[model samples]
Target chain A: MNPMNYVILAAILFSIGSAAVLLRRNAIVAFMGVELMLNAANLALVAFSRIHGELNGQIMAFFVMVVAAAEVVVGLAIIIAVFRARQSISLDEPAELKG
Target chain B: MQSLIWLAIALPLASAAVLLLAGRRADAWGHWVGVAASGAAFLVGFFALIEMLGKPAEERALDTTLYTFIPGSDLQVDVGLLADPLSITFVLLITFVGTLIHVYSVAYMEHDKDRRRFFAYLNLFVAAMLLLVLADSYLLLFVGWEGVGLASYLLIGFWNHKPEYATAANKAFVVNRIGDIGLIIAMGIMFTTFGALDFATVGQLAGNASTTTLTAIGLALLLAACGKSAQFPLQSWLGDAMAGPTPVSALIHAATMVTAGVYLIVRSAPIFNGAPDAQVVVAIVGAITLTLGALIGMAKDDIKKALAASTMSQIGYMMLAAGLGPIGYAFAIFHLVTHGFFKAGMFLGAGSVMHAMNDQVDMRRFGALKGAMVVTWVTFGLGWLAILGVPPFSGFWSKDKIIESAFVGEGWQPWVFGLTALIGAGLTAFYMSRLFFMTFHGKARWTDEVHPHESPALMTVPMIILAVGSAFLGLFLAVGDRFSHFLEPVTGHVEHHEPVLPVPVIMAATLILVAAGAVFAWLKYGRAEVAEEAPAGSLATITARNDFFQDSVNRAVFQRPGQHVTRTLVYADAAIVDGAVNKQARGWASIGEASRKVQNGQVRSYAATMLVGLVIVVAVIVVGGL
Candidate 1:
């Protein structure tokens, strides 16, 4: 029907990811939520291109997907390192930077 | 010869420096060096006096500049010396008497371990006293004034091992500082009024100043005089100043330093002549001191203390004479010269007595000493006669003139001062004869263990020279009215004014009163037995014996108030000044503690703050777009 519906779906997905990232104590769960938020932003960019009847937004969405895939690899590696060192990958466990 | 005025001061000063700086190495010959320096100064001063005398009276004043005292200033003052008839007269008196005391001290302090230091201080005092009279400017005179004060303090506390002697020294210094304040204030006023502190400028410009300024200066100078001369309220220190060596008593107290006040008054005659009210106050202070000194003198049991009281009374006469303007200036100087010889002689005679009595100062412990200390007795007797104003003695010529001048005043002023001077003279006779008779004529009061003997030749020789001077110097100076003519150049011409009573009548009255006083003294202390212990008598005697309760009055008037002020200031400084600083620091510390609560090591709170800051920035952009 309308391209606006896709944009609404992307917004709902981004809110769910933000809630998971804030509420979760595990570092791996929070990283996965961040990945989900990046994919929702890419979905919004593609839906905006369809509404405008131009291919530029779709091109930006393709580029964002490639970057998100690479970021997932680096984020998973860090979570693995924190787990090995502390025996727990929780954000609260590595709260050394807190005031 | 005029340039040689500096040598009179330098000789003694250089000797003092050497004796002090060389320490123990110079001890053996220090006393001899001190004596030789003083003797040479006397010779230099004597030649200077002759040179000044040879010059005409108008040209007698010779000024020599030493240096510019304060360079690149609006105020002009030079460190200079003025050699004139007046200053030369003082120089001759100081150097002559000072040298004799030095020689006497060679023997007087032969047994003391600190005799070298004693001679150094003595030489320092002579140099300072010479400079005091010779200084051309008030600024330079102040330097000499303070020098003598320091020397007096050192000598007074010469035996500082004793706590009381140290206390006495402090008392003399503190009391003199009061007078010094007056002098400093006077100098300040002079600088403001005339832009010069030299005597020539002030004396010439004194007529242009208002009576109020002149009177203020005169009164300030009188206060300075009273402090130095031991007059009235300041007289409390003189009796205690005798704690110094007897030679100090003779040289500084009797011969030189005490007379400085009279010199100041006579030197500042222009100011006094303009300010008659200040002049009257001076006379009144002189009269009161004369009476008070005599009263206290009559009650003292200590031989040295008695002489000190007598010294105060005699200086009072000189002060009174000085207050009478040109009419009495010459007589004041004349009396001062004569008093220097006799009073110094008497103090030395007292020292001789003490030397024989194992350093005992109590007159009650002395009796029938006339037979043993022959030279001391004879010399002391001549001084005694001179002080009593007996015929042909120095005191009669000068003191009699003072008494006659005091009577020449108009109306009630004459009666008050003349009667006071007359009574002071009578009281002087009573007390001096009492002193003489009690020590030498009363029944023996000492135990068998004590032995009285004459002081050695060193002491007796000075006493003999002073005695001879005391005996005939009055007639020698007064003959053909030569003394008056000699001093006229400095004092200006004193018109021949008749006394209120005839001259013969006044002289006769003074003689008769003096005779009556002597007779009364002989009946009380001479013929009567003196108990070794003093009696606790009535109020008058008790007050007189306690130095008129002067210490008590000063304590109540100055000391208690000063303590309260100091205590209040300390409290204010602690509570107000310190509290303000502490409060400011505490406020900042509390603020820091409050700010630290936000930095509680929590990442969630920091993220929340960042979110809130972003929301505020978005809201501001939205509102501006609307």
Candidate 2:
């Protein structure tokens, strides 16, 4: 596959994910959108590295996976706390600090 | 020898430190500490003067550069001292008069609860003034300049319990800050143009610089001087400064702070001489101040406030003289010294009157106390004579020189100066006599609770000495060649003018003017019948009483704009600035709130989202990378 085609696909996926994250009222949809954006960025990096013949992209992807795992642990803990307090999962209703 | 200079600075600082450390306990001994410190400083100044005089003229211009204070490619400033004729003269005046005022304050402030703080502030003022006069560079002078302003703020609001006094202090400090901006800009210009801030170096550079650069520097310094000296528009604060104690009015207004502007111009005379345009501006500003101050003085009923206006008027004469170039420099300094003696004495006398009359400052409430306070009466009479440029008194001689130089000098400059000085003299005599008659000559005006009496020797003694100085100090100039010879090396060229108007002619003209003013005043206000008659509600009286409409104009123009700026612009801008920052904080807070909602209490939803996220991530990477 041409690296350019992979890069184009990744950019499209990232834009779609960002739009989903911004527009969705559901917390679960937003979480999936964020994960899709991160994975799309990782895919773009891997494609560029393959075309350039560098190990640096592979190393960066490995670190991204580790960071994503750690983020999941912290995010779940935060979700559990919020669930205990609010008894709802609506992102729109959660904006209690807005002007 | 260096230790002597250090001692002059250290004594006052030490007193302040002791007062700060001892706090209220310092009150009992505070007066004595202040007196001793200032006395010691005066002695050092005396020694410095003696040493300065004994040296060859070349040796008299001593420069004690402390160190390079600022290290930069473009500019460097030195913390230094210049013991030239001008600085020496100012040092002697500040230290000597400061000592007397300190001693007088010991008695004047005896009943006050915050005597320690008063003494501390007074000592600090002396040190700051000494630093101001003794500093060799503009930067060091500025340090002392601001230091004096700080001390003035503390001293003016010594009775901090009074809201008005506190407000007056704030007004003085803020007005002075406005002037300080001029000094700072002048400094920056000096660095850019000359690469030095030392008076001698800058003076040397000013001689060679283009007229435009010199004019820029001169104008900047002139603005600074106007602010410090309270000239024209910046003069309102001096009247309000009467809210301070009487001695403060005496020391700061008469002897020290107000003279700083004159000193700055005189010290930078070379810069001014190089830029004749700037000198004209100085002369014109001086003339305006003289006219304004004298007119305002005519209208004041309060004795201290009138004298405050007189101080501004007298400083105007000095500024006028300074603007007359080299010939006027000596005259300005001479007038400055003589004015210090008489002005300080007059203010002290006014203070004595207030002290006797149950703290009543309104001259309308005073009359026929000349017999009761004999010393005050005599000393103040001499001061009045000296200030009015009366023949045979100190003011007459100095005023004569300034006026004569103005007419006799190059071009039409002399005529312009002479004319203004004449009018200023006439008005000065008229107002000063009015003040004297109202306070001392007529029937007793105060009620039973207020009885006039003599102040104690502590206050009267300084007045007596100052009276003598005011009467005789001007005679030193009669031997002009010797005086000029002594000052020449420090001042560069001393322009000597052959008396174009014969001494007899000048003296006769001045004497006639003086006598005319005195006779007119005697007829108008001095006679018992005239004084007994209530002042008429004539337009002139109303104008004089209203400070010739200048105060109203100031209120409408400057004061209102200033208030608007502070209340509307500054307040609005501050609110807007703060609002912008607060909005950003709110935005961040809202984002945090939105993020918090994602963790709502639903385990099933969280699990489903995690699975969906996993599938999306896997699909995006696999499909995109294929």
Candidate 3:
């Protein structure tokens, strides 16, 4: 009923997605979680536009969705390459990216 | 004539370079080359001396610049030769005596494998000695001074196979370096005070210098002389220097290089004239050294070491003479020349004796050699006579003149110096007679295997020539007081004096004491049963035997402290210097190890750390806003 409820729901979704990305061992699941986090941000942007009665937040949300599409294309390609080379998509197994 | 002066040094230097460069290729004839080079230098010097003498007395000095030795904005030194009465006299002495020694070494070193190298060093020594006398400026003279010292070191250690011989060379070098400090400081002071280093300029301006400055310079020069001439405190190295070859002992140690200290004092007469206190110190040092050297000479069984001690005493006489102002300079040089002839002859004779006796230097093992080594005996006898100040011998004219001058001043000064010199003369006679009797007069002491024989003709010829000089040189030079007159242009006239002890009384006293000493030595050791080793008898005998314990004193004073300081520095360098660096590296390594634990190459750990930092930043921002 309140516009704040949508913002709160988006924040909860973002936290869940971040937790999945951090805790998951599989590379494909971690990538999916990242996309979910981006969508949550887009939802918050759209809700904020509605609350302000302006088009600025909605436009930012549209740009973010485009960026998410591009990110998905690149991210899937990298995961597929790593899976072929190592025969595994576990983030813990391919820990070469860690400091 | 001026241009030809350079040839005196150049000839021997070129010979040295050629022989050294040719190496083994020149081995067959290198010694001949050295001989010929020195001979040519002698001829050049002889002609140069004649030409110089032909000039008017006041016009005899010739200063010719060869090149710019050192060039700078504030200081400039020319590499030039000064051919004056004083320098020409030295040129003759160096070249003539050097030529004889070179020829003598040819035969003396015939059996040695390193004869070529030996000759090369000899030539180098002659060239440097010539330059020392001929140099116009203090800076150039210093170059020659160091040159001679280097040549001496090389020749002393020529037989480097023997460990002690090398040690002896090192000892001579280190001791000389101590003396060189005085010379270097004196030059620095002269440069500051006179604004010049040329002999003529310094001599002219030194008269106006403050007495304190003059005294410092004079004392500094005396220290240099003490080192080179082998006086008192520095006398220890001279005896050790006998470890070198016999020819080297003759030329560098006895005749030429050792006398350079005397030459330096005589040349700087103007400076000494201005510093009476410095002159007094010089005389005292001479007196002490002469007695010390004589005492040491009496105790040594080694023939070369005894001669070395005697050389020290003789140079001490020259130093004493040089200390007496204008009157002493001429006599110092006169004594230097005579002493050069006799001392060189005696050293060569010692070498000849050693050659005959399987190179054994112990006089106790060398008795009854008079018939076996006739030439050595005859020549050494003449040298012994000359050294004892016997009339008609070279030492009488020169040494007597010095003793006379030592008593010229009134009061206790004359009495002390005159009595000291007289006593030194007696000591000289005692030790020398002791050396002679022990070596040649006593019953046969050599083992059955020893077969003593005369040296080859080459060695004896030089000895013969030097013997003749030692016998007749004084009479020839002192006739009409010509030597003193000849040196007058440079040294100025010495004020005539009424003697403290009448001249006849002094001469009679010296003669009587010398005779008594000879008789005493003869009775004590000449007729007594000579032992393989002199018994360690009284405290005086032990002190003399130990070279007055000077070496022990030096070990305690300088060497022990130096070693302690060095050890402490070494520990500090390891503990502090290295520890500081190692501790810093260890600290960084521990930090790296702690940081490495955070980099476990795990994605979850890195993410957690990032989140924690983010939460802290957010909390701070929120708190500040509230």
Candidate 4:
């Protein structure tokens, strides 16, 4: 596939992940969706770096991966706490913070 | 003598500083510090007076610069003292009488918890009064002027626990401010005209100033004098100011504050001499005020307020004298000094009565006190005689001179002023007699709880000394025109002419009228019972009792209009200015409320909002690119 196709594929994946986060009620599912969106962005960054013949975008992708990994650790911890407190990880259940 | 002039002002100032700074630690004995300091200042002033007297006529007026008061590029003022004939006389009066009052206050204020604070304020007032008379420049005089006003305000409201006393203090302050504006304007005009603030330079230059300019200056000074001396329209405050402790009333009336007005008029004689029209107005004001004071005095049952009214009238006599060109300047001061003695003694006597009567101020409630309070009765009786212009008393020598001088001008001016003064004299005797008799002569009016007794030696001694002064000060000061001759270096040569009205005739007429007034008062109140509340009577009686409704007039003329204006301004400020600001805040708040709804704190809701924003941005970019 062409480098443009890779970018298009990553964009579609980002949209799908965004839809999952917007549609999902479960905390774990939304967190997984966020990770998927971050990976999709990394894939597009790498593809653009190769097409431009530059290391700047690829280097940026590496920083994104590291940030995503740290986000997973904190996100799962919060999700686990929610689950332990209420016996449910549903995002809808935590709407106690509604304005 | 010139170098040591600073000590007269400094000694009391230092005492005030020490007493104030030492605070409660010195409360037990701080009053003695005040007395000693004032006494020392009196000694300094005494030596200075003697030294000035010893100097030849040409060399008596001396000015000594202590330091630069205000140094600038184009303007400079010196912190100097002028020990001229005028100032030396004031220095002697202030220190001598100030020391006595301080001694009197020691016993008067003994029972009070804040005696230290009271003494400090007294010392401060004396220092300020000395500064007012001794300063070489108008600016320095103003500094001292404001200082005494502040000190009096504090002392008037010393018993601030009472709301009415505080209100009285406020009234005194606010009323005096109206006069202060006149002083400030006069000072400004004087500085502009003379290019200097020094009294010597201004006095010399005043003769050359245009009649219009001099008139403006004179009128302004008169306004200020009216405020300080409690003349005419400003006379109302003096009665209410009796709210202060008796010593304060005595000091303010005698040597320290009220007399400053006469001092100013006399000191600025050159200015008044140049403006004949202004001088005439001054005389007219004096005439009207003296009558008003005497008329009001007759109606008051409060002993201190009656004395206050008497003080106002006596100062009015001095003003009348000071207004009469060169002929009356010395006599004005002569009257002022004698008035100082008798008025102070009378006020202290009133204080002694109040002390004995459990702070009762009504004369109607004070009958049959003569036998019990022997010392106060005797001293007060002397004061009463002195004030009534009885023969050989201080008032006879001083007040009669003023009355004679009133007729010095030719034709109708003399008749109008002379007749007014003559009538005022009769009224003075009438009211003072009423006060004395109502308090001492009638059958016992006191309640069973009351027991009248003499004041302590400390208070009585001062009254006795002042009584002695009242008895002889005029005779001593008036012999061979010695007092007037001593003041000639400053006032210039006062023409000694044949009497306009023969002295013997004037004396006989005045004494007869005064005696007639006294007999009238004795017939009316001495034998009759006086009710605590004055019985409703004629229109004239009601008017006199209400101070001619001057306070009511002031309220109608100025206060109500001012309140309406203030209320309108407050409403406009609240609705318009605050409305604009609050509207902006409310606008932002409403927008914030709408925005706050977006933060539902639900993970899915925030994501959905972000997705919608992202779609809008992407769609805009795509459409633009196409």
Candidate 5:
């Protein structure tokens, strides 16, 4: 694929992921949005590295996936705690410390 | 040699450290430690003096760089020491009198609970003042300058439990900071012009610098001197500083701190000499201080406050001498030494009176103690004589030289110095005699509750020594060229004009006038018959009782403005500034409460907001990217 095509695809995925994060009130949906954003960044990096013929980008992608999995587990645990305490998994309810 | 020089700085610091670490258990040890530290420092000063005096003119020009304190591109300042005749003289004065004051404080403060802290602060004050005098660089001198100021603040507020004392301390600190600003500006100018803060380098630069740069530096330095020396506009703080314990007043007001200004001007004599305009300003300020201090002294009823004003007046004389240039520097310093002894003695003697009268400071409450406190009376009498510049006293010799220098030197200096000195001398005699008569001559004026007695040997011993010093210290200058020769390296070649015999003769003749003033005071207030005959309704009595209208003036000018400022700040904090902040916080809390009612644990409203935010983000990305 051309570099321009790969950039367009990454940009579309990033936008969708950011929209998901903004639209979601549910903790589960927000977690999914975060995951999508991570994947979108990985896609861009891999595409760019392939165009440049570098292996470093692939290695970074692998690390990102591993870190994403860890983050999901932690995020789920925090959501579970909040749900148990407030009987709600809505992000709006958890915005207790906002200005 | 370096080690000994470092020892001079280190000894008092070590004593302060020990006193601080040991706490109250070290109180007894602290006093001894202070004595020992000052004694050792005084010894170092003596050695430095000996070394300085012994060196030939060529060898005496030795300038040793200890290290650099501030590493700026153009404003580098070295932590160095100069052992010149001038610095040696000051070091000797600080350490010698410091030791005596420390010794006196032992007995003077024996009854206080926190004696350790007192001795620690006193030792620190001496150490810092020594640093100021010995510093080779302006920046280093500033450190010492500010260090003395901090020590002054600490010593002034040593009895911090008293709000009045704390307020006085704050006033002194703030007022001195105004002067410190001038010092900072001077440093900035020196850095920009000369690229160095080392006195030697700056002096060399100043010699060849443009007149404008030299004047800027000179004026800035003069402002700094005026603050430190308690000249004119900044003179009020010293009077209020009498609220501190007496030893602090003696050390700061009389001996060490106030003299820092004169020391500064003398140290930078080259700068002032190069900038004659600035020197004129210095002379003018000094003249104002001379007249103002004497005028204020005349009306003061509190013995310490009167002496405090007298000290300011005397420092003005020294400043005037300094303003006259190199020839005046020696006379100024000579007067500084003599004035230190006499002023310290007077303050301590006043402290003795205060102590004896059970903390009563009003002169009206004191009388007929000449027999009871013979040592205090005699010592204080010597101090008065010395301060009045009476014949053969220390003040007479030094003061006469300054007046002579003024008369013989250029400009209208002789008339300024001669007139101010003569008037100041008469007022000095009048006020001091009034204080003496009020305290020792007439009938006992104390009520039944207050008993008058003599101070302890610890106090009287220092008074006796200082009294002896006051009686004879002037003769040091009279040793023909010995003093001038010793100080020649520091003072350089001062131009000596033809001896102004007529001015000295006129000044000597004015002593008769001073004597007449004393007699008048005696007839009006001192004689037993006059004391009995005078009605309480007399104008003189009312004016004297009210401190010659100065109390009202102070209340109107300083006290009212100070109170207004305080009230404004308090009001702003409580009603306007803080109120706005608090109101904002309360509004936010109320808004949150009103918003909370809409929440109702509802999921639908949240969903709607989320959808709207999602649409906004998506539409922006799609439209903007396109």
Candidate 6:
């Protein structure tokens, strides 16, 4: 019944996803962490929508899933191109973008 | 409607326009066009003189308003031409002498490649000088004033291929601009005090203004006069200005343009009449310059430079007279007209000598030229006699009047000015005779390579006409106080006053001093075997040779200090003004350098930074809700 508990769960999941993205060197693993963060946000939204007696959060979660699917196709294609070019898909391998 | 007065200025102006715009295409006939334009302007001005003479003195002034010059809510000025006795006198002098000079230049500048440009500038000078005399308002007069200044600069630097000549031109322009500042400030005061810039309105309302305002205007006009007339402090340029063409030295520097200052003073009779302090200052400046010029003239070995010094001294006499009030205004103009003749003739004579001697200017290099150039000698002799104030000659009539008028004031004023004038007369005689004897009367000093011959009739004819004016113009004009009566409507009639000394006694003393001076010069440069090289002499002689070291004094007094101030300002600009901007720029750059660390190409670092920012925002929200 407590919507605050949902926010707390979302916070914990976001922390874990951020740790995976920051700690992992593989580009695919970091991308998977981004998907985890989005799912955690969706979970929090649904919990809030139920507490407020609305279906808006569920509709937004479906929209986010569709957007995430499109993002994965483009991001994965970019990572594969990077692998072809430099023989690596690690995030740290693209140091050409360094300041 | 003497609207035809504008034609006097327009013809030459049109010629100048055509020659300047046509460029090289006008070269073939440009000089002839220039001569014709000047001649036509003379005719217009000559007829205008006749028309003016037909009217009574009061009705002689014909004001022709062409259009509005500057339209304003509070200050409206008209571009008008005034044909009056005073202006007509100047017009006849300018146009007549101007035409003669133009004709002389046809031969004088016969071979120069830039002869067309030379003629264009000469025509431009004639038109501007005519406008300066004919303009009905101060604003309009200033336009002509600046026009002549430009014409003068162009002509003086006509041979700008030479660096020194260009520098001389710049010197003249810069000095004249300094004088022009006084005119501008005077006009500003006129606009503020009288609510108008036109001559008539200001003249009528000048009495209503305070003496302080009038004095300010008077001093300003004097400064302008000093610059234009080459009097005192502004005189260094006159000697250098001989770098211009011979006709230019004759026309603008000697005759017309330089006298614009005297004209300005005489024209603004009302303002000067109210400011006695300003008048005294003017007279003092005149006296000092008169003596200084004579001294400088005595030492110059260059014929043109010597004559330029003489012109300065002669103008000083006019200025001294001008500063004496209405009593001396007519005499100032009288001397101006006659000096316009003799000095311009002598300059042309110098030109003839130069032309004959293969452009050699040193008097030591010339001698016994009188035999080769008879017509030049006779005409030059006439001008010498006329300037010496010899009896029945022009200067005796005109210059003596100025000398007499300079002695008309009260107290020690007459003594100082009278003594200065007398001393100046003696100095003039010595120097001018020295020049004449050194050139025509002494043993031949020229080298075999240079053959002295008479110039063509084109040059001699003008010298002849000017010589005639030098000899008879004064005698005819001064026959019955006729010149004074003609100028009375503008200058106002002043009853004759006895000078401090009896006129006859003063005249006798002046003649005696002149004789003594001529005898002295004869003994030094004529009777003795003159040295081919100038021997280093006394400090006094060296001082005169160096123009009294005026340039050095000016550098020390104004230029060096000005440079220092400018340099200090540049340093301050770099340190204080720019320092603030540079400091801010460096501060921002350092901040940017620090911020660059955050943009490191590390996806893991960026994600960690974003996670920390998200946590901070969520914690703030949670604490606020609790």
TM-score against truth, every candidate? 0.85, 0.83, 0.89, 0.89, 0.78, 0.96
Identify the runs in model 6 with alpha carbons over 4 angstroms from their true place: A1-9
Error of 3 at B52 (Å): 0.7
Highest-DockQ candidate: 6
- Candidate 1: residue B239 lDDT (0-100): 85
CAPRI class of candidate 5: incorrect
Off by over 4 Å in 5: A1-99, B1-3, B499-504, B528-626
Q: What local distance difference test score does each model get?
A: 0.90, 0.83, 0.90, 0.88, 0.82, 0.92
Q: What is the lDDT of residue B581 in candidate 5?
A: 93
- Residue B571 error, candidate 6, Å: 2.0
Q: Write the per-residue lDDT of candidate 1 for residues B1-626, one digit (tens) a residue.
A: 78878999999999999999999998899999999999999999898878878888899899999888788669757889999889999999999999999999999999998899999999999999899999998989989889999999999999999999999999999999999998999999999999899999999999999999999999999989988888877888888999999999999988899889999999999889999999999988988988899999999999999999999999999988888778999998999999999999999999999999999988888988999989999999999999999998988998999999999879898888888899889999999999999898889898667899988999999999999999999999999878888888789997899888898988888999899999999999999988889988899999998999999998888889988999999999888999899999999999988887787554445545765786699799999895
Which window of 10 residues has the lowest lDDT sum in candidate 1 chain B?
Answer: B599-608
Model 5: share of true interface contacts reproduced: 0.00
Candidate 2 ranges with C-alpha deviation above 4 Å: A1-99, B480-482, B498-503, B530-536, B562-598, B621-626
**lDDT score for residue B223 of model 6:** 88
* lDDT tens digits, residue span B150-238, model 2: 99888888887899999988888888888899899999989888888888788777878989988888888988899899986677678
Best by TM-score: 6
Question: Model 2 scores what on Cα lDDT?
Answer: 0.83
Rank ordering of all candidates by TM-score, starting from the highest: 6, 3, 4, 1, 2, 5
What's the count of clashing pairs in each model shown? 1, 3, 0, 0, 0, 0
lDDT of 4 at A66: 91
Tens-digit lDDT string for candidate 4 (B1-626): 65598998999999999999997999988999999989998898888888887889989988889999789865689989888888888888888888898999988898999999999999999899999999888889899989889988998998989999999999889888888898999999998899888888898899889999999999999999998888987777888899999999998865559888888888888899999999998888889889988988999888888888888888888888888878989888888888888898898899899999999998877788899999999999999999999989989998998888887778688888888888899999999999999988888889779878888999999999999999988899888988889988988886665446786787788888999999999989897767766788799989988899999998998899999999999999999999999999999999999988877888787778788998899899999895
Predicted complex 1: CAPRI docking category: incorrect
Between which residue pairs do clashes occur in model 6?
A: none
In model 1, the clashing pairs are A99-B601
Chain B of candidate 2 vs. true chain B, TM:
0.94
TM-score per model for chain B alone? 0.95, 0.94, 0.95, 0.93, 0.88, 0.97
Give one digit per residue, the lDDT tens place, for model 6 in B1-626. 25699999999999999999999988899999999999999899888888888887799998999999778888788999999899999999999999999999999999999999999999999999999999999999999999999999999999999999999999999999989998998999999999988788989999999999999999988988999899988888888999999999999999999999999999999999999999988888889998999999999999999999899999999999899999989999999999999999999999999999989999988888889999999999999999888889999998888888878878999989888988899998999999999998889999779988999999999999999999999999998999999999999999889999999989998999988998999898887777778889799999999999999998999999999999999999999999989999999999999988788888788778888898899899999895
